[model samples]
Target chain A: MTFRAERRGTFRAERRGTFRAERRGAFRAEVRDQIAKWRRDGVFEPRSDSWLTGYDEDFSRRLGARGWIGLTWRGRGFADRFVLTEELLRAGAPVAAHWIADRQIGPAIARLGSAALKQALLPGIEAGDVRFCLGMSEPDAGSDLASVRTRAVRTDGGWLLDGQKVWSSHAHRATHAYVLARTSTGEHKHRGLTEFVLDMSAPGVTARQIPDMRGPGHFCEVFFDGAFVPDSAVLGSVGDGWGQVTGQLAFERGGPERVLSTYPLLALTLAAAGPADAGRVGELVARLTALRRLGKQVAARMDAGEAPIGAAATLKMLGNRFEVDVIEVARSVPGVPRAAIDDAVLAAPGFSLRGGTTEVLGVVIAREAMGAVG
Target chain B: MSMPDVEEAAVKVLGGAADMRDAARITAEQGWHLLGVPEPEGAGGTLADLTGVVRAVSAAGLSSPLPELHAPVVLSVRGQLIAPWGPAWENVNLAGEPYDIGDAPSSGAVLTRWRILHAARLVGGCQGAAARTAAYAATRVQFGRPIARFQAVSALVAEAHAQAVLAAAGLEAALADPEDDLVAVAALATASRAGTAVARVAHQVHGAIGVTQEMGLERLTRRLWAWRDLPGEAELEPLLGLLGEERAWDLGAGDE
Candidate 1:
């Protein structure tokens, strides 16, 4: 199976006037060769979602070395990032180590971080030498970010962070933790929150893995007993964390990652299914293709400097549903054993729960859509 | 022009109602039918452009004489058959039903574009119904408070909006490139199903008023059921049948 280079400006002649996808160039050849080499070396198994929880530091660093990590900050648009990410996911590469950094943290730093923070972070991030985990959801906060109780009190030199963060994926393995904590009291719960880029090895900070349905959990519970983060570590302005986090959510939620979690299994099912299962498999591919196209459209809008906040949430919600639906449908495939797809089936529920639960996304999208009509 | 621009223009031209005679008139008066006339027909736009116009017309719940209007114009403009016309469209519905059947052209490009337009219309109709349901729930008082204040009604509205949004995204995806048969099929399937669901929710929210013609909800809801059948399950199966035979499922086909 030969991987074809993406054509430039081929589909959608209607997009002539606005927000054209970045034209394909030499990077196509580069990414194609890299993927081919990885396939030959058997670096990772194809058609597996094991990479979601898998931690291969060297593999991530290899991707960084090949300059595949931070396509966004290196003058490449989201279209380029989409191409690279789709290829990685399709190959089932172990990307969890760099996933957070490459996807959200890196972009967040590049956009909102201070110059000092950016300089210290971007290089390590791009090199895949520094791994980062998101520190958002707290014990009391899951969908409601405005009520986070984690406090980042201003200290003599910097800020003293004290509180607990839950559902932090890969915190135990990450080198740094990007956290949002309350900074000052205000009339609104969303106010007074600030984003912090913390050194995970710092004193007074503790991280413990949380057991989950899937064994060897990637989620972690992080506690801070006055962990000192320098003022330089603060990302964006103090009170502007809400905006920063919202933007980060846009980056985090609206990608191929949301929808393609179970795609490996879906592809596997199609490859191995009998003639009786053809109709179901065909419907699955058709629906998945539509959702993937939707993701690409979101990427194009983001490239054009539009947040498309509502559209992003809508895509993520649909994507979450699609991921779970694919896994459930695969259960009926004739040749594939029910146990064979259990890993993906187990992971299916988390697709929506992790990045803003289905209910939260639904509210966000409905509000935005109704507000637009108003 | 962009689809939004086409949508805006179509809304201004066709308003929110559907009529066969109006479609026939608009096809002749505004040169809407000439949008995708063959290259030899002298000064015709791309199928992508025509697809946008068709999407706009469909979204606004207006009947359109597109590929049907193409035949006479193509013969007059190009002096030859650009594409063969398919069987005439015949469907049953109270909302926007076309009583007079015209020669519906069946060119692959036109068929794909029409299906995309049909999907976009379904999305638009679904969105209209969803908006009405949300508005009704917000205002309709029960137990001394708006029904929308209740989780039951709110959740229904949210689901309706989500369905419409899903269909809209699919339609946008298909509109991006109307040429891909698979994408068109997917778009049609997603939008049609969404449209049907949205129609049901709209009625559920509106109660008996939605069934009465005075509420005018059926104008959008009934059309969704009728138009959904054009590229319905039967039509999608053959295309999907081909997809089922494939060894590898490669959905990463878009240029972007």
Candidate 2:
């Protein structure tokens, strides 16, 4: 064997249990099923028209028979969906809608929704027939999200929401968008914001999808032009938005989906190559082996309902860096080309900046881990 | 895991006393009876299997570390040491700190929990080597001469090599016979010293790469520090003291 071949041949001689693909749940199984179907059948690829538009009405309703959405809350079946989320992201499924609802909407309602409020709207969301978007960051309020100036005037009829939300992923597609509005001034920046599930179809709400350089059109600018909301629309208590959003953010930040986004493409890259790329494979194995374990640790924590807030943030940051590293490493292999052919690398370059940027996540880790922000 | 499995296996092997701690010292130095390392009995396994079930429990999200360590002691009172059985064994622990578990970690229940901390010490058994290499590798020159040389690089590898040696010595010593000697204590000290330093030096060598997200060295290093802080640190001196006391006791018994 040549020098390069020798290195490649001995790459994995010392390691064991290298692969990290998970198949632990029915939900995950269904996701695996969908992923297989999508790849083999050449299923729906995202386009301009299909991006914000809801799925076929009957198709969506049919999809809800098994209750794949919101599977792990109380009174619900123990079908956990985080693994489902992980699988979907790994498959590169257009899970933007599901990500929004599962990440933000479901938790907001379950925690703060009034009994009547919960009874009326939750089943549709639970069934995936309806979707919700988060309205957290404003144009000026990127990392300082609490600096949002959205106002909800308490009039005789109900709340009159007049605010603008930026970077609202899936705000245009959702049936309802859970929004954060400032009800009253408080000493703390995070004190006054209140979380509300706004009916996007209601009068005066405008959502337009905006294109971004990294991966255009997953984000939007949502404007509530005196959007009328009944008192029932308030999720959690008024002025309890800060606490509610914090809890929601913790749930959002900590999930297996954050780590396994580009996994399928990685599998594809490996499958296409032969034995010449052995040493690279060895390094990848060691990395993903430890990473999978760390992801499992965080997942176990989330599954147990103990939001490892600090630890989760640490994982999120770690995962983004790891993902970026994998991309760099994969691109350098002798067999692989400099640029992706089917647009894999360029398609999701901004994933690191999504959900929460690595820098913002650093502050979170600092506050919760180091106990500095008192 | 090794602690408990070896402790129980120690009782089963030299079945004289329930407190394998007394008998374990002789087993530690005279030969390699401990799991993994080759010995006269010729039985061996990894840390995972020896302490398998208990460690499995901890790995599967249970809080207990190694129940086997305490199990032998728990059963010790039942066997009277004066009337010997197969082989008389003595054990003297050389950990550097007490369990400090708020309540005494003296009972079988507590000792098992304390061992988890001990097991964590093995997590990044040689992280210091990685760090030691990264520090210079990032800045060091090659043929012109700074000495990172490659991705793994040598200085850190040597540093980790030393750390692994310490860990090996510690593991070996923990299984020694109850002969009441310094070799066993030295083994524990050697392992602790090496294990702790390996993690530090590995980070030092690796520089920013050692702790960065892409860095594979952080968890090992973190686990080393975490394991080092375990209650075992307090136990070392006491174990050494016990060795001195046991030798006196043995001499007294011999006179009788």
- Per-prediction TM-score, chain A only? 0.91, 0.81
Report the TM-score measured on chain A for model 2: 0.81
Clashing pairs in 1: none
Instruction: Compute the lDDT of residue A8 as modeled in candidate 1.
Output: 18
What are the per-residue Cα lDDT tens digits for candidate 1 across B104-215? 3455765665566556667767777787777777778989997776766766777788787777777766655556766777777777778778888888888888888898
- Candidate 1 ranges with C-alpha deviation above 4 Å: A1-14, A17-22, A25-33, A47-51, A337-339, B1-22, B38-43, B67-110, B134-147, B234-238, B241-254
In angstroms, how far off is A249's CA in candidate 2?
2.7
RMSD to truth, every model: 6.9, 18.5
Error of 2 at A44 (Å): 4.0
lDDT for each residue of candidate 1 in A1-374, tens digit (9 for 90 to 100): 10011211223344466533355535555776788798799886655554466578988999999888898889887878987887677656778899999888898889888899999999999999999998998897667877888999989979999999998888998999999999998659878889999999999999999888866589899999999999989988998898778876778788888877877777667666666666666666666767777777778788888887777787788788877877776888766656658878777777878778777776776676557556
Model 1: CAPRI class: acceptable
Global Cα lDDT for candidate 1 = 0.72
